[model samples]
Target chain A: MFTGLSAFPLTPMNETGIDEVAFTRLLKRLTSAKVDSIGVLGSTGSYVYLSREERLRVTQLAVEYSEGIPIVIGISALRTREVRQLAEDAQKAGASGVLLAPVSYQQLTDIEVYSLYEMVSKSLSVPLCVYDNPTTTHFRFSDELHGKIASLQQVRSIKIPGVPNELDTAKERVKQLRTLLPRDVTIGVSGDPYGATGLNAGCDAWYSVLGGLYPDICLGITRAALAGLSESADNQSKRLEPLWQMFQKYGSLRVVATIAGMQGLTDTPNLPLPLQGLDEVARQELKNILSILKNEISLP
Target chain B: MFTGLSAFPLTPMNETGIDEVAFTRLLKRLTSAKVDSIGVLGSTGSYVYLSREERLRVTQLAVEYSEGIPIVIGISALRTREVRQLAEDAQKAGASGVLLAPVSYQQLTDIEVYSLYEMVSKSLSVPLCVYDNPTTTHFRFSDELHGKIASLQQVRSIKIPGVPNELDTAKERVKQLRTLLPRDVTIGVSGDPYGATGLNAGCDAWYSVLGGLYPDICLGITRAALAGLSESADNQSKRLEPLWQMFQKYGSLRVVATIAGMQGLTDTPNLPLPLQGLDEVARQELKNILSILKNEISLP
Candidate 1:
């Protein structure tokens, strides 16, 4: 069911609780930009850092104001039962689907990984998007495991990270996934820089990072690529190259949190102590990049 | 200062909440068996899975019932600020020291890694033990970084993981740490099989795993090694060779959870869903191991 650009934003927070006003405004911005769907409490959303109650509160706010932009709740946990419980909670909260990345501190076996998706997906009526994020979970899904997991009853989609491997191109990886997976299973690629290329190469969706702050820009690129406008998509991607470089260098978490603060969305943008956003030099660089991109890209 | 054997157990849980009765009983069992110290809310304790409130409750129970034994609280988080807050919370809760691993999903630079410890240690009044569990954190520490962290003002100890790496033995790593670090700082090693060897090589402590369920065995090995009784220490370690092999094959988290369940400490062991504790066959193998060890090593 998941297709096109899914915008994932940083969870704006203040000292007291979530900055509801800023968050609502951000949601409104996404709806205005007409992104395909919105992924809440994702890695970009800092789900791990928030407490259970706080995370639920976030889920509540997201569901309440997503308008028609489908809200796919990220139900990630170290435990399988917790992931299922979270999935149930998301369904009750009116989530369109659930996203899960089986996170573990221990080295999990292939069977362990398969069993996890099997249990959670079977229990959910809504679509479950298997998040293949090796950076966060350290659990890589082989093509064989992907095939086994896709057979699970409610696994409707697969969200893979942007593969920057020198040998295999993202396009080729998408092609392999398309061939390996069932036809109904939606294939989406995340990681801002690699997204445009993946979408152009036949991925069904782009689970976007830049879409969080700049939904219009991401939507522009994603739409262009999807409509077979490769040149336009490449140009749009080139326009955001500076931000992509920052994401590659410092990660989307750091860069996104910095951008949220720079945009004056939330005061306590950086959560989980001691991790301050972009340093002074990087802040200036981000500022210049944002200004140039703003000038280059206009409303659709 | 923490020395000798420190028992670390899994935090028992049921549908209602934390299984406090079972937890208390496990604590009592360790205390009666005479562990030198008790590390509660540690990795083996499932620290990351528990909520902030739950973690504090567990910490409170640990400190209150510890009687005379010191409690070292695990304060690992992705953010430096949360780690600092947890350290402050632990101090307030009457903990002896805090153990931190600087866990991050994103890869951290040497500067970022050292900065995390530097900032947190500066903010903490109590001793901070540097936990080097690269397997869990996915962040390996260089000897140079370890030397710098050991020089932190409040850092009183180093806790290295049981490295089976051919390039770096735990003993050699301990020797290097002891030389590079200040003379007063204590060096401890975890990963049960390596404890006796690390202790014999000059580590002042052994932050153990098996000690949680069977403190007497670990205590015997640690004490013998501390007292320069290599023959006795080797004998004690050799006694645990089977369990050590299981730990290597599957990981301590799986093996320990099974041991706790097999010992009837908790019926529902913490296996982190999708991954159940050692299956029935493995459980039977474990029961055989425990029954044999119980026969071989009598209670003090």
Candidate 2:
């Protein structure tokens, strides 16, 4: 289930509540693109910012709209009990797998984090993915800890932060981790700019932000890399460097929200308050970049 | 409202949920001790671990049982919308002020954080305290940002993480911050081990976890420091070094929960899951330390 491109869409929302119409449109777009899997309520979806009812509703919508694609629901929460409840809810909502990040308010000890994963894994009937997103969760997992968690029952995949930019080093890093994790536990890479590098370095999946929005282009890169066409994959990724630059500078969430809003895929105030869309200057730059990219390569 | 010894109690709970009897008793203890203010739902209270309904109920109870002593409610949340709602609910429940940490999942920008305070401040009728708790929130505040936030109309105090261990350095750090803040705004210090040093160094309030559980002894140190009796304040704080050692070794939250459970102030399973009480060895060490302290100083 965690083998290929997993497209994670934005859960557009405003003051009234979740933009159901906009969100449904996004789900249909991913299903139409035939991406490997659809990830709902991931970091890009702002799962932590939502209420339990809202998260469940989104999960149900994604499963219903994704047209048979496997659904992975992010179930990160501050409390272990809540995380367990969310995991159970997601599985009940037809989730193919669940992603759990050690979302913490207190500085969590290694033992506490281990216990969190251990306890939640027990309640899950479906596969579980260890989401190691230190940038957002602020909980870094040691290699030994990652190994310990991956060996747990129901643990089938590990979503690593990002691989090194250098192709050889990225391969070596992934190789080192491969030996630590169980043979069946797939290693998927996040941080979109290095998608080709990670895939070419032998990562099993690309858990990508760009894939969530522009599934066709991301699928093109993923299919090429997986088929041993590393040059084609790298070329396709290089062609989107301007977008990656904006993502690096303004953050992928804001950049993606900007695209989603400008493209009319979501409402004007797509992101929740305190997490606004890109400012005027950044928006203008993104628009200019998109125009240039459209001339260079195909864009939806 | 934001001065002197502000006791921050644990919102003890178990599988059945918040122990109202235990919580009410803790609130009464703070009121009886005549602490200058009561800080409910601060990090020690596990505010982020709870739901909005639970947090609101806790706030209402704290205001009710504090017997007219000022109450500062922790209004931190991942989303700004929730924080605003919590703040409004807290004020409606008769809280004197609110404390907001830029609680985040996505790493927040300086502008995003500043805008959060600005927006929430507009809706607040009561004063707000800038909770710069980097250890928990993982959002560090620059002096420039602190000056900007402290100047906001509703901002009445800045709860700094801690002062330096050395007395001279602690005084200089506080003095430097004093210059940055408004004349009317006060400065409170958290990180319980530094309570006496912070007070002696001119922090207007000691936001001590120890103060919440053992108010009489903490009050003695706070009062002595405020009266310029540095030696007495130091002596009082030093007498409890064994307790502080446990706090530094095992987090203050865990240490406090252990004590609360041992003294029968709260239920046995006081802390939320994933945040267990001290391990057996640590608990035994704590028990020995408490016994030593009881003989060394007057313990309740």
Candidate 3:
């Protein structure tokens, strides 16, 4: 059920509060593109920065406008009770699934990691997707631990990170992960620009950032890979080459925000403090790339 | 005014809420111990995990109970507006200074770092102390950026991290930082077990964890180093060697929470989720060390 290009919307905000009008437009664009699901309040959504009230408001609105689209709300929090609370809130607000990452100020042992998932999943009636984002969380889950989490009753999917430790090895790891876990567990991949290799490896879906911007491009890449059309998928990835280089260089944040600026979507770009978009040199580089790939990168 | 051995109390919490009575007792003990200052809501204090109301409540209690000890409240947050609001609250509540760490999920640039400190410091009447905890913040302040932030009008002190890249070179780095930075900025060292080395190298203060548990031992080491009594300082450090080894092995988190557990301070150790205390084997070792160092490490 947790498959295909799931759009992770960037929460639009201004000085006063969440830019509700801008958010509505973003949601409308996502549903209009016919993405498989909406992953509201993911890291790309700036869930960490928003207050509880504001976070819930985003979740409620995503559900209201998604119009039958499955919503996976990001419920990563610093405490177990808070995580559980966010899970219950997500369920009550009609979200289809809750995504959780073991976010900690200190490193967590495997036992603590298992108990966190167990405790939260018990409160939740909907499915939970274990988000293995070691880059941001600094907590890595071994395959042994992944199996342990997947064995939990409420867990229905695992979001394999799109970051490749070694470019060649990442696809093999995804293939290995596909065969290792329970067949019941859907294996979705995030870091969507890099989604082609994972999808070709028989992963379930692309939990995407580009799916939020222009679902057609992300969907094109994934659908091609799913149908055993590697050449077609490679061509799509080639077109996104410039943006992928930026993600590799300085995270995907500035590139996405800069693209939003080029579009008329946001005035002040709803990024968290101290995380500005591309500097002048990088901005110019981006412009040069976009001028060549303009039709491929632009929204309707 | 931010000099000498400063104590950062662990915020004791239970299922109900913040253990206010225990927190007050913790404050009174610090005041009685005559440590330099009180830093509330630090990493040990679990500031990132806490709600705004709970954080403010702890701040109020720290100020009220602390006889004349200067209070430095940690105001690290994901958003600038939240940081500004906290700084204003700290000033209104009579805190001596506010501590800001440019904590973000998004990696920040030098311009963003300077602007974060600038935005918050401008709203405050009190002095601001910049906390450099890269392990938790994942944001390193290059010496160049440090110089820029220190030049801000309201930033008077910098909590220089004492975590060594190499044990032998840690003190040398402190010396280099002291030389490169402005003479007026008070360089306070954290990672307190290593305080003797940093203090001996001319750091002005010790931002301490053990001081919250046993101030005399930490203060003794810092004062000896300050007085140029190397042998006396070395003895104090050698007495606390077992605890330091544990901090090096794991983080100082489990050991500190374990000591608080042994003291019967609270039913729960008050650590944030997935950051539990030491395992059984480690606890036995900690007790053995305490038994040997009882005279030196004991509180009044």
Candidate 4:
């Protein structure tokens, strides 16, 4: 079962391409945190924008720095064959598991979606985690469809946003799913800020997008929750609330990247256009929030 | 500079893949219609769903059947590098030009989007057509950005959907752009039904999704418009109204593929997943409309 916090680290890039120095600095910072697992090449990491060679380099960097920590590699593309190739590459890089999202362009049929999971899962010996980010992929899998995916032998986990409509239903679904799936199968919650609620609702694990920047605070909240200290977890969440609010105020996920840059993990919070980085006002607000958090939260 | 009717031919697939027989049939049907040009491996042709080799095969097939006809190949992917490679391949395959969409998944900044186009355009010897399909690509290029792309030497055309909001403004923008761009540079419309209106407004050409199913009808409409016979053109468009209404009912562009399948151009009207084939009722409706059109119109 999924437990503790999984941090999805950003893949640093520059004009020459993959910034190994910046990536190494990020990896070192993340490894120092008490995170349960690390995710590489996910949407937050800008996996889709990378070349095949760049993807491999980033995956290898994550795995190497993981030391003994589990690494879940993101393998998503517009074609199944390319995704399969990515999965193989991730496995070769010694990633503990792979997260696969459906090809975005062609809204695949339910049958094709099932086959996609089946093919990728079969290709790798490692456990497979389904990454469903409907906002980006534009392909939403119904709960019934996810039920079918959960039935696959190699599919050991699911990484989904903790949307309100499906949160409770997903909790029950996962419970029902566990009966038919392997005991090790886990349901992980993404979309931070709602992660604690999802964790309380019976998700196996919760991912922290802001954890790369504020590891101690995120880990504290996760630790409190795991210890069944609801009051302490609630306190930590409230203390971290303002920082997360900065993300919301910025109006996009790129704000999370901006905050990471403010914390010295990345050189610039630059996102590819038509998604601009945090404007000056947003960046100043983010800086103020970071300063307050630094004074308040105990270092990891 | 962009005007007239352009056909996007289906990249026919069989059990072995790349069905040259079906492709030849489609090419023959479209060429005889005297379509101004042919667009290969676009959304309708399932470009993102194809493998690199398959994309090459489709490009080669289109070039061969072009028989001196202009063929514009769609170059779109998550990685700018792959897009550049595809653009190069398209030019090498004897394509008259290339249509490029921005990198999918990540929300691109205007600068990043511009760089992507610049890189792709610079790598290919042939002219590049910047395709803006915001619905699928999730990133919309601003009029300012389009103007910048238009100014690029290799970027010789702009292909935009003929939606209401964009139609008039895009025409005016392109009109001003024509003066800044080369004389041969063109502005094309993707939405076929609105082609005549756009042509009259100032666009150079119209890319047809329906051309594969009813090439003669589309050609007749374009010919009538070119001959300055508005009533004749309207009558031809009226003949297509029934099928177009069916497409409107489905409320998606994928309906074009289903209509193609119904016309016996392909065995399956399938479009990946999430985009199901027309239901029995829709299929029956399409059959009735197509039957009526076949009888009413003198198709070549």
Winner of 1 and 4 under DockQ: 1
Per-residue error (Å), model 2, residue B171: 2.4
Which candidate number maximizes DockQ?
2
- Cα RMSD over interface residues, candidate 2: 1.2
- Report the CAPRI category for model 4: acceptable
Off by over 4 Å in 3: A163-168, A295-300, B163-171, B295-300
**TM-score to true structure, per model:** 0.88, 0.96, 0.96, 0.82
Tens digit per residue, CA lDDT, model 4, B1-300: 135777877665542466677777888887776677888888777787676788898889888887777888988877665686788788788888888887467556687788777766667777788888886787888877888888787888888777343446755755765665557667776766666655555667778787765677777777776677766776677667776676556644557767656667766734543345777777788777767877878642
lDDT of 4 by residue, A1-300 (tens): 246788777776654588777777776767787578887888778787777898999888888888687888889887666787898899898989888888577555676678788777777898888887786788788877877888787888888766453446755755664565456678777877766666655667777677755566677778777677766776777777886676556533577677656666677844533345676877788778777877888632
Arranged by TM-score with the best first, the candidates are: 2, 3, 1, 4
DockQ of each: 0.49, 0.74, 0.67, 0.34
Q: What is the C-alpha RMSD of each candidate to the true structure, in Å?
A: 3.4, 1.7, 2.0, 4.5
Candidate 1 Cα deviation (angstroms), residue B134: 1.6
- Greater-lDDT candidate between 2 and 4: 2
Model 1 chain B poorest ten-residue lDDT run: B162-171
Number of the top TM-score candidate: 2
Clashing residue pairs for model 2? none
